[model samples]
Target chain A: MKPQSLLVPALVAAIALLVMTDPAMAYLDPGSGSYFFQLLLGAVLGCSFALKIYWRNLVSFGRRLFSKSRANRPSEQQDGPE
Target chain B: MTGINEVKGSFRDPAGRMFRRDGVLYRGIAPQGLDDYSMLMSSGLYEELCAAGKLIPHEEAASPQAPTDELRFIRPREIPFISYPYEWCFEQMRAAALLTLDVQQAALARGMCLKDASAYNVQFVGPRCVFIDTLSFARRQANVPWAAYGQFCRHFLAPLALMSMRDARLAALLRTHLDGVPLDLAAKLLPKRSRLKMGLLSHLHMHAYFVKKFSSGGAAASSKNTRTLPRNALEALVQSLRSAVLSLKSDESSGEWTDYYDNTSYDAAAMDQKIRIVADYLSSKAPAVVWDIGANTGRFSQVACEAGAYTVAFDIDHQAVQRNYLDALRSGRGNLLPLVCDATNPSPPLGWALAERDSLTARGPADAVLALALVHHLAIANNIPLESICDFFGDICRSALIIEFVPKDDPQVVRMLSMRADIFDSYTPERFESVFSRRFAIERSQRVGDGPRSIYLMTKR
Candidate 1:
């Protein structure tokens, strides 16, 4: 497998290890279901958040590329009759 | 700590206990809470929250002697009246839920997190909801999910969603389930279409499934199995929960009394006169705290509020209470609180030893009570005797009672009697005055405009 593909799994494993090792002191019982659900939701939301940021970046990059190409074109050619 | 009487409901948290010494409420923080207390004070979160009115303000009180078990004593400003979650209208409950979330977010920003999200921790001072439990905060630990996540879902999200989507009456479930409505029960009770919403599905439906799956035990026994939630992930989770809460809207369409003002027998002139009468009585009494029983949309309660009295407008109808609450919020009336309460069967004492939450009557005898256009419903519709109604008013009113006695000939009472037998021969104006006079001195009585109804100003004996 490619190193880039291994990165995600490695990060997940590291996070899981950290989660297991961290000691939590809570007076109220954080139910097993609630704890696990939060973890699952957190991961999903984190990924989506990252994806949203990247998506916006990608869109802006595409816009910049398209605008650069348009700018390269002759002004007279872009506007036929103004 | 020797003379102080610990608050019964405050025993759950080991870090501190709320106690009263010489009628002043103080929190005695244990040695276990020293670190967190210092962090809270040093981090400036306490000041920020108090300034924003999100938290109840407190001051360091002089301790006679620093006991070994006690770290510090803080005297918090007393809440005039304590009300429970079940008594709160839809908007009030929603406001409380949002306030809890906002406080949680603020705490997170200061490297702290709420250790518990019990609805009991949130108290309403008029229209604004404030967090009262100072010991609920703990220093945030990295790679751990919120300890109060399940509680938030149960205490706030589940009930709020149920009230918004299913039925407004479902909010009363909070009375029975002191911890909060069970997620599984909430999931089942919610409409099937609610599962279609991603927020509800993930937070409630799926969360319930996970809880049930792990209920048999051993699933959460080993810390090695716990999955990490990074700080950003935790923030994302809180944001998602906030979105979920925000997405659920309060249903203002339900309840019988939402449109009652428009359909009442009283004309505009009569209502105006009635308002003036109530205001006159309130001003004469000069009550600091007033409870407007059956305050539909809080029209007369507003008069009491305008007369410089902190008023609690209560109604059995959820929509009416919600409408009243919204009006209070819009008008920025900090002295007016609208609550949902059935006069017949009000909120009873609940929780551990049945002493944790005070019964409706236990919190009162308010300085005054405004029972306007409500006696007929209790006496005629509910078949409650005039004597009993008078006795009840005596029990709930400390000094003054400004109650309207709608006679049998009144249009509203006549309409009410249309649906039931007019067996209440004793439900007469003379009988009302006679019975109430047993417990109170009738100071003044005036007829409402040209109507047969009369508003009485009585002082409790």
Candidate 2:
């Protein structure tokens, strides 16, 4: 049998183990502490992802601010896509 | 303050609803949504996305129709054509996915997140997928798993993976399931080998597992009621999803209709003459908007555009539409839009109340329509009768139509007949003329390439 094909049982066991070892001693439901932790993790991860995405934009913005050649830019007669 | 017209498709996002007044589209920000809309407006993310041509830009409407009720009313730039995901080729769907991910990443950077990821919120303006829903953004919260992650997967990823792995026509599943194809369905339909692929395995297979386990009531919250996904993990998840989406390369162009142009009997000179003739007909009655049906690779769409008509190139083959879109990008032409559509079962009026999305004909009464080298396929292959075909064409175009008829002995038609028994006894040039002439006044007729086949330009009677 392929090792990859064994993940179904492995995953089921992992879930079973997590349920058995629950430290909270109560059914926490959807709003449980661990779920909150995951959400928090997601938010922080989102912040970092955003930062990584805008790094190039930040550098370009900095370059434009520092460059003398960018001093005189024409104002838009209309607002639209450049 | 009297007129109150809903934009029809904007009811989902409670933050703001798209409305219309005096024929102009306006977004009315609700009280609950005002704070987030205000945050987005001040954040400069909107300006940046617009500057990059990634987001559709809007302005405060000069005068509000409902001034007292609205917090901040603005008018959005009108999208020339609104096309749904089902109508998109594989490449277009892929492009929409990339754009959504980029928007999400950008939104996160600006301390905002996409509240939802619906392919319906996107509209194509000249080869670029621009997000149109102004209220899709909300202030980002700490430790929240991407709320729209599941939606993003369904709307963009599921259909894409299904299209790439299972069958290209499976993309049409978006049309039937207005909320996007369900994960369980996609997971089941995907091949056994797909389980080995990491991205597909985790996002699709594992995702389906969780959905079934938690949802099915058999295992009632197996582990914790909820699970924690850390920042790094969430990023990894998004990245993984992106990789899964990007990995699917469309292998569409080699379909049945793809090689139709190659097998054509028309020589270069004949092709040029046909284009000139079509262009001349288009110029005589310069249509405001033109629809080129069976526009394989959009060769005739370019002719319409060159002759100064905004063109919507509709082709059944995804690869052909993809190529047409790429050509539009390379040529920097704003007038042409390529869409995948099987003329017989063209995209129907779909979504809530059947009006959320416009049907193929709902977007039309095109000022002019070009139905070139398409009749034989509809008549012979698909078995649509000629009179019904004429009536369908009649329903879509108002001013003019340029259609071609390939004769029974023509190689393409003969090839179509070679497989099936010839039931079409009335498939004569004379019969064709008489049937169409009932609905359309023949403006002009010319035989293309010394063949029995002919092209006719008609005015709807």
Candidate 1 chain B minimal-lDDT segment of 10 residues? B217-226
Clashing pairs in 2: A29-B225, A38-B228, A38-B229, A39-B143, A39-B144, A40-B143, A41-B230, A41-B231, A45-B231
The candidate maximizing DockQ is: 1
Give lDDT tens digits, candidate 1, residues B402-434. 988899898877787787677988877888888
* Native contacts recovered, each model: 0.66, 0.09
DockQ of candidate 2 relative to the true structure? 0.06
Per-residue lDDT for A1-82 in model 2, tens only?
6433433433332232223221222111222222333343344444545455456456766787877444543333233445
Each prediction's DockQ? 0.43, 0.06
Docking class of 2: incorrect
- Give the clashing pairs for model 1: none
Q: Which segments of model 1 are wrong by more than 4 Å?
A: A1-19, A74-82, B1-3, B64-68, B223-225
| Chain A TM-score of each candidate structure, as shown | 0.64, 0.34
Name the best candidate (by lDDT): 1
